[model samples]
Target: MIHFKTLKQANHAFMLLIFILSSLFLSACSGQEQTKQKIPIKDEKTKETAVPLVKEWKMPISISADQGEFYKVIGWLSDQQIFYVTNLKQSSHLYLYNLITGKSKLIYKTENPIVNVQISPSKKYLLIHSSPSSNEGLVTIIDSKGTELLKKTFPSYDLDFEWNPYNESQILVTKFAEDWSFQLNLLDTKDASTTVLHFPEPFIKWINKDEIAYLNWNRNSPSLDAPLSFNGFGTEGEKTVFANIIQFEVYRNMLMTVSANKQDKSMADYSFFDKKLKKLFSFSIPQLSNYSDWLVPFYDYSEGKKQFITFKPLTSGDADTYSEGFQLIRYDLVKGSSEILLGGLENVPLSVSPSGNAALMGNSFEKIIDLNEKKIYDLKRND
Candidate 1:
């Protein structure tokens, strides 16, 4: 005779397995579509073909052109301005386009690809740095009119660079080798004289002109994938553990460090800090997938207004399911509430609008997502 208790236990286990499998199946077959084919609509006025805007100003890229015909938009100065880097017959050039005008103008052209382009806080000057072709990386400082103010060369190869907003002469360059180290250099833009303030590890970061927030790398039993890591300043600063440290934003007398952590297998933790290394508040994501990449942080500083720090995680995935995808999250540090601005797609964070309301990001598939509207703009060239 069969035992009734064992039979009941087997039935319950079978039901649990079915429930788990059904949940996964539904998530995989969700309504999210990843189509790269062109969806055409007739322009009402010109009688030309145009792709339908899912939301206002959505799908900025042309949906019918060949790969080389599409402008590779590299950065966004504001919501209204976009910068594109492209090569014409192997000669690299930079163009700034006014999105409102729908017109593009050449800004600077060089023999090499523009690796990094930075605009000053005042919007008066542009710093253009190109990869090293012969000597060290060359930096050219030019005004808005494309007039070259000064040109200089730094000793090491750099992939990342940022300017000090307060002191235009001071610049920070990231040198990547076996590990990430930074060289803080003070430059005389007139004479191009440079003095380097060497900082150890990948922790060197600029908060403002007078102050720099530095993080000390953990050396004891190092694990790159460790859930927590220590950060401080130059062998003496207060030690803080963070899962992923994106950036440090300074407003008034307070300093804010934005970081994220993977709490468990699925949940993630996001935190912001004050100047005294005190935690103001922490946000968490409970059901996010783990196949995410780099986090891009955007901070806004306006007095008496709620400050927001946005985190955009890069991801990779497939058509049937989200194999990997990035989520854009905005944290209102004052109110301590986190909003998932955009999610459920693959993207690489390019730039955020100066007003902190929108951002422009792209994926390998040539799709751009506007975070503020929660819409996907097909950047795929249609012409």
Candidate 2:
């Protein structure tokens, strides 16, 4: 009877242990299932939402020197064509070069020496200014296909003209008198109409389609203390925007100004103003540094972003004689920060692409810099 009771107790203990282990295993499996249910699964849409990298491009093929003698670059007519001028012994010729095919075709030629060339913003027309004699100047408007549109002669000694950015048919011409005073005239190519304004200073630029900004000097005040005002002219007449502006330039809807310092003549404050005449930001630089340095607007403000590219001189001196190098810096107006793009550059930039993605450096061997990619390319002629 004792041996049978012991065997029954051992069997009962073994069954109890097995039941506990089975319950623990079932609990562990349930916990694992619950954890998996809480986790999220990735879908195809999530994988497709990643942003692509910016596109990279190689430099265009260089042109050979034997093709044509290029003196000055007028501008880029398109991404593939470049307009340039060449001065021969008795004539000046304008040529259009194809970047891909490495071929140049003469578009316009002038018997008189070419003084200045300006192209319309639409790239459909070009204004060629030439001086037939010391006191005689001729302005001709021509299409890109070498067809002449309009020609006018000016008896004045100094003649300068600029095409209206917004209007392909309007042009602004300045005629300087012998006394250094200038007269501003608006020329309409469509109707051959001309309007003379009372404004004297010719240092003006188009602010928009209908508005122009120019410098207005307060001659009533003392010569040394005369305040220079930034004024806007449109169909509504004239309006003063800012006072004591020493130098200014308008880029798209932004205006950059250098105001004279009354307290310190050796220093000046550079300021940026929006289209509504609201001050955005201001910084001070030595007056001497302004001569050797350059302030250029980088990207446009189409998407509400403002930035600038500036060249800071490593050493200060007269701009004409300064031998020191410079540092290229990019400044962000919103973040109020700056980054150095390049340093120890011996030459200043000769020209910048319209998109602001590239710049041509005027070094001993001219080089083109890809501003977005931070790459430099040799702008030499391919042999």
Q: Pick the candidate with the highest lDDT.
A: 2
**Model 1, span 1-383: residue lDDT tens:** 33446667759777778778988887766633322122222234335433233254424543222212443666556556766666554456666666555566778876665666777765677888776563367788887767888887665656456566667766666655434445556565767776665554544445535556554435675432322233322445444444444444455445555444544533335455565558776655433333333233333443334455354444322223545455666666677666776665454544456555445655322454455576656544454
lDDT of 2 by residue, 61-106 (tens): 3444443444566766764466777777758888876654557788
Q: Return the TM-score for each candidate structure.
A: 0.63, 0.68
lDDT value, candidate 2, whole model: 0.66
lDDT of each: 0.54, 0.66
